[model samples]
Structure formats: structure tokens, C-alpha cells
Target: MQFSSIVGQGEIKQRLINTVKENRVSHAQLFLGPEGSGSLALAIAYAQYVSCEDKSDHDSCGVCASCRKYQKLVHPDLHFSYPFFAKHKDDTALSFIEQWRDAIIKHPYLSLDIWRGYLDAENKQANINIAECHQIIKKLSFKPFESAYKILILWLPEYLDKTGNALLKIIEEPQPNTLFLLVAQNQDQILNTILSRTQLVKIPCLNDNEVKQYLINEHHQTEHAAAEIAFLSDGNLTEALAMLNNDESSYHDYFLKWLRMCFSNKGLEIVDFVDVLAKLGRENQKNFMRYGISYIRECCMLLAGAGNLVHLPAKELDTAQKMISVMSLPMAAAISELLEKAHYHVERNANPKILFLDVSLQIVKILKFKTIPQGTHYIPN
Candidate 1:
């Protein structure tokens, strides 16, 4: 992947290119960033620039032999190591190379949940097993087949367990011309020993404007739709992309209607509403819950006299202001917690009908009866 192909992160791309230009390329570097921030794509682009036979001043030439191979992720000198569900004792990332290539090529902003869909995951735990650790050592032992450097990009080193220690010697004193690039999200989950050895390249999340423009220019989103998704996504490109696939435009109306039903204590209507929610499917259900949570939080902000911090658009802001007149801060908090719990359950494949009914009842208790549920305390006005 070329740096131009990745969205945003202009400073990061230049910095990575500078490392190569100045001949200060670190053999082992960690590209640490939140998910959907294009950290993995940045790492791949950096590696391609390093391996490019006809490198330009700012980026790699897309037509060179090395560039062609790297674009397809079939370069002999370019290797990848990532967390996988190993079915056998000797299974390594190489076993799922084709799946890995397809998934990454399809969406470089891939999350673990998306990757799980690519494999026969079936509730299996994903990790870099001892076999993969040994495989890394063996792979790095070889010399570069074509490029100037042999690059191994290990995604999510946080999945590496204690067995990752087997590569300590190599990391500390790697063979000449061998580079280890580790792409990870959470720093706290990684091994301290490995963390200490690698050079840290921090990548920040994309800004709201960047995500908004990308949706408009690349995805052909309407200006208003792009703005709404960008605000709701909060710098998460993966979430924005997912929202594009689903019908999130009606969330505001649906959420407002649900609140109206709960507030009026309309039992029969709520049951029908629950039936409709149950049919949204898992992703839509989760997105709907998320929309409700965000909307409720905005109401809470208004109730707490923090209207300046709210990010809702004008129409939603008008609705939020009107809603806050009838809702108390504590009630909004309670309902927000309920929506959060519903979102969690939806992610775990809960029965949507039961989950929505339960959540609706909880909202009724808070809004109509002004009673907070057990285990969730809200400060009284």
C-alpha cells in the first residue's frame, strides 16, 4: 500500500519516509495506534517504501516490481505475522496467509471482530501461539530474497504470550538487514520486555473532518449524512464505514419514538417496538443501541448545563433540548447505562427481542417512575 492510499496521517507518513531517507530506519519499530486509525496501513506503506526499487522522495513508486508484489502482499521479502486461531499445535500465521491477505486487502482498518468473520473462528481464542513464535524466529533466520531488507510486520503483538520471549535474543540483536515491525493497539497488553526493545511510533486517530471528507469524496455520502456519521463515529473510521452499510439515518426518529413510548408507559406499543428492533439483525441492533446511547448522553449533557460540550446537529440538538426539559440528569444517566448494557448484550449475540424488552422496561422505570435500577446509583437533584 502506498502512503497516498491511506487516509489522513500526513505527518506520520512524512516521518516514516524521513526515517528511510535519512538512513535511520530502526530494525524493530512499533506502530502503536487505536483501531481504525490506519496504523497497520501506515506500517505496510512504510515497508513498501523501504522495499521499493524506484522510490520517490516522498513515497514508493507504484509501478516497480517490488511495489507490485508489495501491493498484492506477495513480496518474497515481505512477511506478516498476526494473531490467529490455531487448530493444530504446529499451525502458524502462514497457514492462514490467504485469508489474511484477503481480509487486509478488503479493509486495512480491520478489527478483530471483522477478522474473526474471515476464519472458521467459532468462539476460538485468537493468539500468537508458541508455534507461531518459533515460526517467526525461523523466518527471520533467512536472508532477504530480493529486497534490501527482510521485513516482518507482526500485527497485534499484544496477542503474544510469554512464549514471545523466545524472540528476545533476536529482537535485541537481530540479524543484519532484518526488520521487525509490530503493529498494536493497546500498549498495556503487550509484553514489557518486547515493548522496551522496539522504537515507538505513535499514531493518532483521524480527525472528524478527515473522516467526513473521505466519506463524501470516496464513498459518495451526502454532506449531511457524512457529517452525522463523522460526529457519531468520533474518529473511528471502521465504525463510520459500518454505519454506512446500515441504515443509521433513522436512528434519531426510532430512538425518539422509543423514548416517547417508555415515557407514556405504552406497554403494548413497546412490545411491538421491541419486535421491530429484534428484526434489525446484530449489526443494526448494535448501531441502534449506540445511537441511543449517544443521543441520551447529549441529553444528559444538556440537563447537566454542559450544552457547549454536546456535538449533536441542529435538528437533534432541538430534540435534545426539548427532551431535557422532561428528563432529569439522573434519569438520562440511568437510561444511558441501560443502553450501554444492551449494546454489550447485542455484541454477545443476545436474543434481541428479550434484550430490547428488558431495556425498554428499564427505561420506563427510570423515565416514567423515576426509579433507578439496582446496582446503578445516580445522584439525586
Candidate 2:
């Protein structure tokens, strides 16, 4: 993909281009960034720009022979290695190349969960096995086939096991004109040996405006809808894109209703609400609680006389202002803590009905009886 096609990261794009312009391109580098930050896309665009026959100072000429091949991800010089469900000991990333190409081409802000959907990955663990590492070494052993550099873009090197050390020789002393671009999210998970051998390229998450504008211009979402999704996503383009088909716009209303029921301690209504929550599926339940957490934070900010820092849209801001009238900063903070714990449990496969019911009871104790949680002696501001 071209740099023009990737969203945000204007500074990073320019920096990559300047690296090529000044001929300071490193042979081995790590594109380190949070998920949905366009690190993988940047790596591919940089490789294409480096190998482009008719390249300009800004980017690769899309019409050149090398550029054409790179656009389709079929270039002989461009190889890719990524985490995959290995069905056999001999299976490697090349074994799933077709699926990988399709997944990346369609969703450049790819995540492990999304990648799992593209395969028949029932109960299979995704990893970069020893076979793949060996393949990577063998692929780079040859000279460039069509372009000046033979590039290997390895995605999620964090999945590489202790066997990753087998590739250290090639990584440290590679064939000339070979580029090893490793795209990863978690630096702590990568083997120390591999981590120390590469130059670091840090990529920051896209700002809210970048995500909001992309939804408006690309997805044709209403300004308000884009703003809401952008707020909920919190700089994650992958999450923003995933929310496109979801009924995320209703989260605010549903969350408010649940909170109101909990505050009233209406037993039957809460039971029904918990039932609905239990059936919304695990991902939706987590998202709903996340929305509650963020909304409560805004309420706390308003109660603390920091409404200026609130980013809620107009309707939500009005609701928050009204809601904070009855709830003190301490109450809002306690509810937020409950929601945070609920979100954590939801991620760990806690039974949704029991989890939500227990959280609702705790919230009731906080909102109705003004009872501080046993361990947390929150002082009202």
C-alpha cells in the first residue's frame, strides 16, 4: 500500500521518506506501535518507495513495474511472515499466504482477532513456528529477484517462540540488500535477542479528529455518528472500522438505562436488564461497560469543575450535566471503578449474567445508599 492510502501518521510518513532521501535506510528495523496505528501499512509503503523505479520524493510512483507488483503484494522481492494456526510441524506462514494477503489488503489496520475470523481457526493457537523462521532465513539467502532490495515484512514477531533464536544469524549478518521489517504491537513479548538487533520506529495512535474525519470521508457516517464512534474507539482505527456495522450509537442510551435501574434498585427490572446484557454477546457486553466507564468519567470531570475537559457530544454532555446534579464526584468515581472491574472480568470470560448482576448491586450500594466500597474509602470532593 502507498503512504497516501494510510490514514494519519503524517509525520511518520515524512520521516520514512526522508530516510530514503538521505540514504540512511536501516537494513533491520522494528515498526513499533499500538494496534490500529498503521505501522504495517507504513512498512509496506516504505519498501515499495525504496524499490520503486520511478519514485518521487514524497512516495512511490504507483504505475512503475515494482510498484504494481507491490500493490498486489505479489512482488517476488517482497515476502511476508505472520502468526498463523499451524496444522502441522512443517506448516509455515507461506502456507497461509493467500489468506494473509486478503486479510491485510482488506483491513490494513488488521488485528489478531480479525485475522482469526479469516481462517478455520477453531481452538487453534496462533504462532510463528520454527518452520516459518527457517523459511524466512532461506528466502533472504538469495539476491533480490526484481527489485534492488529483498524485503521480509514479519508481522507480530511477538508470537515467535524461543526457537526464534535460529534466525538470529541471518538477522545479525544478513545478505547485502536484504531488509527485515518487523511489525509488532508489544515490545515486552518479543525475545530480547531479536529486540536488540533492530532499529526502533515508534508510531503513535491516530488522534480522535483523524479517526472522525476518516469515518466521515470514507465511511459516509454522519458527523455525530463519526464523533461518537471516534470517542468510543479512543484512537483505535481498527475498533472504529469494526464499529461501522455495529449498533454502537445506541450504547449511550442503553448504558444510561442500565445505570438508572441500578440506582433505583428495582429487582425485576435489573434482572431483565441483566438478561439482555447476557445475551448481547461477550464483545458487546465489554463495549457497553467500556461506554459506561467513559461516560462516568465525564460525569466525574463535570462534578470536579473540569467540564472544559469533557469531550462528549452536545446531547451526551447535556445528559451528563443533568446526571451529575444528583451524583457527587465520589459517586461517579465509584461507579467508574465498578465498571472498570466489570470490563476486566468480561475479558476473562466471567459469566455475564452473574457479573453484571453483581456490578449492578455494587452500583446500587454506591448510588442509593452512598456506601463506599469496603476497600476504597473515596472522599467526596
Candidate 3:
């Protein structure tokens, strides 16, 4: 992939290019950033630039033979390693290279949950196994076939176990013109032995304006819609894209309806609503709860006389204003706690029907009876 194709991270792109320009490209380097921050995309573009036969000062020449191969991720000298669900004892990343290529090419801001959808993964944990480590060692043992450099991009090295030690020697002392790029999220989870052997390339998360503009320019979102999603996404492009796919206005309506039902102590309607929530699928349910939490926090802000800081759309702001009439700051905090707990439980595979029913009752207690949940010590106004 070309650097020009990736979004934002202008400083990071320039820094990576300068490394190639100044001939200071480190052989073993770690590209560390949060998920959805374009770390993997940046690593690929950097590799492409390094392998580009006709690279310009700003980016790679997109029409070159080397650029063409790199763009399709079919270059003989370019290799990839990542966490995979190994069905057989001898399975390596090569077994799923086609799926990997398709997934990455489709969305470079991929998450493990999204990647899981591309595989026949049935509750199986993904890891880079010992066989994959051996395969990596064997792959790096060879010299470059076409290009001047042999490059291997290992994504998510945090999944590497103790067996990762096998690649230590090769990482420390590789053949000339060999580059090892490790793309990872959490620095704390990586093996210190491997961590100490590589140069670090730190990538920051995208800013709100970058995400907003990307949504507007690429996704054709209106300024208000894009601004709301960008604010809610909090620098996660993957989440911003997902939120765009799922209607946030629907979330607002559903959340407001649920709150109104709970405030009125409508048990029958709540049971039906819980049924609707149970069928939303796990991800949607989590997003719904998160939306409720954020909305309630905004209500809290309004109740605390901080309306200037509220960023909700006009209709949602009207609802929040009306909500403040029935819900005080303490009540909003109590409901926020319930929604937050529900979110945590939803992520851990909680039963949505039971979980939502329980949360609804808690909200009823807070909104109707003015009794805060036991753990949260909030006195009603």
C-alpha cells in the first residue's frame, strides 16, 4: 500500500519516509499504536516505500512493477505473519494468507473480532503458534528473491508466547537487506526479550478533526452526523466506521424510548423491549448500552448546568433538556452506572435478555422510585 492511500498521520508518514531517504531504516522495528490508528497500514506503506524501485520524495511511484506487486501484497520479498486459529498442529499463517490479504485489503483498520468473522473460528482462541514461529524463521532464512530487501511484517506480536524466543537470533542478526516489522497494540503484553531487540515507531491515534473529515469526505456523511460519530468514536476509526454503518439516530430513539418506559414503570413494554434488545446481536447490544451511557452522561452535564459542553444534535439535546426535568444529576449518575455495568457484562457474553431486564429494573428504581443502586452512593435531589 502507498502512504498516500492511508488517512491522516502526516507526521508519522513523513518520519517513515525520512528513514528511507536518510538510509537509517532499522532492520527490526516495532510499529506500536492503538487499534484503528492505522499502525498496520503505516507499516505496510513503509515497507512498500522501502521496496519501491522508483520512490519519489513524498511517496512511492504507484505504477512501478515493484509498487504494483506491493499494492496487491504479492511481492516475493514481502511476507506477513499474524495471529491465527490453527486447526492442525502444523498450520502456519500461510494456511490463511488469502483470507489475511482479503481482510487487510478490505479494511486495514481491522480488529480481532472483525478478523474472526473471516475465518471458521468457532470459539477458538487465536495465537501465533510454535509452528508459525518455525515457519517465520524458515521464511526469513532465505535471501531476497526480486527486490533488494526481504521484508516480513508480523502483526500483533502480543499474541506471541514463550516460543517466540526461537526468532530472537534472527531478529537480532538478520541477513543483509532483510527487514522485520512488528505491528502491535499493547506494549506491556509483548515479550521483553523481543521488545529489547527492535527499534520503536510510535503511532498516535487519529484526532477528532481527522476522523470527522474522513467521514465527511469518504463516507459522504453530513457535518453534524460526522461530528457526532467522530466525537463518540474518540479517535477509533474502526468504531467510527462501524457507527456509520449502524444508525446513531436510531440509537438515540431506542435509548430515549427505553428510558421513558422505565421511568413510567411499564413492566410489560420493558419485557418486550428486552426481547428486541436480546435480538440485536452482541455487538449491537454493546453499542446500544454504550450509547445509553454516553447519552446519560450528557444528561448529567445538563443537570449540572454544563449545557455549553454538550455536543448532542438538536433533537437529542431537546430530549436531554426534557430528561433533566425528571432525572437529577444523581439519578443520571446512577443510571450511567447501571448502563456501564451492563456494557461490561455484555462484552463478557452475558445473556442479553436477563442482563437488560436487570438493568431496566435498576433504571426503574432510580428514575421512578429515586433509589440508587447499592454500589453507587448517589443521593437523589
Per-residue lDDT for 10-119 in model 1, tens only? 99999999999999999999999998899999999999999999999989999999999999999999999999998889999999999999999999898877787789
- TM-score for each model: 0.88, 0.88, 0.90
The TM-score leader among the candidates is 3
**Which residue runs does candidate 1 get wrong by more than 4 Å?**
120-122, 261-282, 305-315, 337-361, 372-381
lDDT of 2 by residue, 1-381 (tens): 899999999999999999999999899999999988999999999999999999898889999999999998999999999999888899998888999899989998998767876876723678999999889999999999988899999999999999999989999999999999999999999999999999999999999999999999999999988988898788989888878867754888998898788778898999999999999876677678878888998899899999888979888899999898778877888889899999988766688899999998888887777776757553323
RMSD of each: 2.8, 2.9, 2.5
Question: Candidate 3: what lDDT?
Answer: 0.90
Q: Considering only N, C-alpha and C atoms within 3 Å, which residue pairs clash in candidate 1?
A: none
Q: Over 4 Å off in model 2, which ranges? A: 120-124, 266-275, 341-358, 372-381
TM-score of 3: 0.90
Q: After superposition, how far is residue 17 of candidate 3 from its true place, in Å?
A: 0.9
After the best TM-score superposition of candidate 1, give how far the Cα of residue 75 lies from its true spot, in angstroms: 0.4
lDDT score at residue 271, model 2, on the 0-100 scale: 92
Off by over 4 Å in 3: 120-123, 264-269, 337-351, 369-381
